[model samples]
Target: MSERYEYQPHRLLRQRVRDIPSGAEGVLMAVITEDVSPNGIPHWVDLAYIRNKSGREFTTAVGNIEPA
Candidate 1:
């Protein structure tokens, strides 16, 4: 007998943060953004949050991604 299954979509967000002093080779801290998928359904990125060393935070539609 064959088994049937349901397909569900999902959204994933990955975040990493590090604290660097005058000189460092590795990151101090890393934080991964929580998954915002509801009902375990598939979803797409709508927005994102990012902060820089200057302590300036900003938000934008999910599209731009690069190493800081």
Candidate 2:
């Protein structure tokens, strides 16, 4: 099972894919599911809210950051 759509302050987000820089790390705050239209079809996307090392909080699609 995966972490649900809730705040997990201790969860770490490390960049392993090209969407984010390698070795970059952050705190995963929450994972929210939203209905999105990428190409017209409604798709549920997991948006990971994170706080970077510099304390800047941002959200990105889940795959760009992995749990560490």
Candidate 3:
């Protein structure tokens, strides 16, 4: 089984694309359990717990860039 991630107490972060093999663009939400890089900035994001304008919850890292 895969590990489960919690969404409660929604946390926000200002992370840079460290790896995007795909050409898609979009806002990505990842588990901030550990720091990835020095450039990976952390911040509180206003998570509404709803689909984005494009009807997506944290798109793939390679997906289109979604607004925050």
- Model 3 residue pairs with clashes: 12-45, 24-63, 25-63, 25-64, 25-65, 26-64, 26-65, 26-66, 27-66
Question: Alpha carbon lDDT of residue 12, candidate 3?
Answer: 36
lDDT digits (tens) for residues 1-68 of candidate 1: 02122222213233432222222122112223334467766444433444545655544433333333
lDDT of 1 at 60: 41
Task: Indicate the TM-score of model 1.
Answer: 0.30
For model 1, the run of ten residues with the poorest summed lDDT: 22-31
User: Best-fitting candidate, measured by lDDT?
Assistant: 2
Residue-by-residue lDDT tens digits, candidate 2, 1-68: 23323333324534322226454557776667766655855566678777776887777777777655
Q: What CA RMSD would candidate 3 show? A: 11.0
lDDT of model number 2 = 0.59
State TM-scores per candidate.
Answer: 0.30, 0.48, 0.24
| Predicted structure 3, TM vs. truth | 0.24
Candidate 3, residue 39: how far the Cα is off, in Å:
37
Instruction: Please give the distance, in angstroms, between residue 43's alpha carbon in candidate 2 and its true position after superposition.
Output: 4.1
Q: 1 or 2: which has the higher lDDT? A: 2
**Model 3 lDDT tens row, 4-60:** 223433233333332234433333354323222346454333232233347555433
